[model samples]
Target: MRGLLILAVAVIPAVAQNPVVHLTNATHPASREFQVGDRFEILITGAANQSISVRTTMRGRTDWGPIIGWTNTSGRWSTSGQFEKGDFGDWSEVWTVGGKVANPALHFSVGAPCLKGGQGFAASTGVNLVISCETADGRQTFGTASDSEPFRTPDGRVVRGRVRSNMTADQYHAEILQYLITSRASDVRSGRHGDEAGDLIMKMIGPNALNEDETRNVLSIIRAAFERPEPIPQTARDPSRTLLLLRNLADSADRESVKQQIVETVAYVLAR
Candidate 1:
């Protein structure tokens, strides 16, 4: 199958300064800028000169949620973030990283509340730069802070997260789904994309992919994408469209259990 992820990195616009962050690799020419969805590496040139924050801020949790914080240890520093599905069918995370570093600081941000996940990093002088992501909700972190691991549904038609660090916005995910559905709905409609998205899914999902793995990643991405700063108001018009999309993926992939779960979720959301 074909996947858009294989496409080369696209160009990005310049990030504003101050409270705004510029996440980039030192190798790129300064003349060019990264767009909100252009993927780039964060390189620390000076000890205290480097800091990155999420363009969006997440609320601190009273008992749970992404309470992300990090400390600098010896010259070695590491920061890790994990997100999992909650009892109420929400994605929540608890993030912490500690290490000594020249700068001794890590910047983290979120698009919504701690409900989805956390984003941050640490810098140590020379220690290994360890960035770990895990989920108790049974989802797999794709090995970076970028996106969820890729996998296929039981039917053999591959599917995975359409969102990544570069496109760290709900609108991005929504647009991507809309594009895929609009393009394929005629043949597959709310179903699966044959080659394009499939090929991209292979690269991300990899060989170790499992059925549960794919389910967790897909739902987490969608829920995270649709999540609001506050709990989705139980309103009739609050993005009830996703119910069909989510259920379609599940049914098309033959995930009966997940499809039923989504149907119930749709009822709850619509009832609100």
Candidate 2:
């Protein structure tokens, strides 16, 4: 995966002037190549009781965006950001506290050399950076439509891009069902019986993808997977933590009925 994680340090000193912030420990990958989808974390510090905010902007672009507030901990704060090849370009990050701008913005680039065949990143063109789908011949599709397209139905249909209009109810349910089952199976096979499967399910279902019946069925499947007595090779499975996954999903449910059903099911399992 081509990506960069920059760790920055922001210092608010006793002197009133010249508040400086810069990346201290920049760990370059052995390849020194960074691409979209890679994340960077910055460690920031502010004056006691000072409020902090961070924002990033593409270089030479008029708009500065994704402004976010920092969570302070004893005059120190740490925040992270990710690169999405969609908006591939030179980028800069600025920090502010108590309405004072921190001098010198952090800068980086997201584009080709990171991708196969040296294709430049384009926002309109979806880019897949996390998972590599290289062919057995070591051939990679770069700059092609298939290069960045991530999710696809088993039938070779792309799942994104006005996808709802194209999918039938049965198709949607089938896709989600396959996703949930596959996620659980993968986690189990990898010796993980924790929240990984649960997290994937929540991400896939999102807001209102599944109806009540679908939700119940999905939860039951997950419950059965968790209940399986597969020995985790690396670490012993924690049943309480496993149960917490269901509880967390229940808490995130928007519908009262769905929430209640998940909660009750979790409780019943706990009783068992």
Candidate 3:
């Protein structure tokens, strides 16, 4: 009997299409000027069953630079990597593929990095996006893209440029406190203080006990507002509401000095 001839067929899987990556400032799609808090988006298509990685670098510099303040907002896409501090003390984020998801869209907010003196970006820093993907066929593809226009922090002039590298920690802390105070004051003047105002105040104080100088500065601002007469536009000055919030914080304060200062400020407001 003739030996039976058997033929084996090898089936090959289809290769995945190369992914397209797009990075844009969703908050201001047409403009390159980004404020302290603005949203940035990364859209990835044709990435089914492929692994992807996203990295960032400054436009001209090869070394990684700070990623502004990157806070992820989208739940659709997930990442295993996190913001890593570089050797130069700058920060950058690497988003590694967590799972195989199709057409992932990522959204994040970019705020000014906390500088030595709470200063903003000194120059118009252009952050470039780099993406790499491994296809199902084991082929690697890489792409580098950036925003349509270079990002410029127009408010840098208002907040002042970046702090000097030689600034002391104490000076940095003081600058942060001053910035917070000035911001809150602006909110009050613009009638932007809302019900969540107290939450913001507490965030400014943080969990640690404030130093004597910090405590004094906070009280001084409260006193100045408390003593001011009702403005022509009543909405312009809501000292009572602000004081009520501070009073609540005072009641929960852990430090005697902080509590005392807040209480004294509240009392002054109540007395008026």
Candidate 1 residue 101 Cα shift, in angstroms, is 44
Report the lDDT of model 3 for residue 44: 41
Which pairs in model 2 have colliding backbones? 2-35, 86-123, 128-148
Worst 10 residues of 2 by lDDT: 58-67
lDDT of 3 by residue, 38-90 (tens): 34444443333333333332222111122222112221222111111111112
Taking all chains together, each candidate's TM-score versus the true structure is 0.22, 0.33, 0.29
Q: lDDT of all predictions, in order shown?
A: 0.29, 0.44, 0.36
Residue 16 error, candidate 3, Å = 50
Candidate with the greatest lDDT versus the true structure: 2
Q: Could you give candidate 1's per-residue lDDT for residues 45-142 as a string of tens digits?
A: 21222221111111211111121222122111122212211111111221211111122222332111121364533333342222323333332322
Number of the top TM-score candidate: 2
Per-residue lDDT of model 2, residues 160-221, tens digit only: 43245677654454445544443444222322343334444544433322334445665766
**Candidate 3, number of clashes:** 0
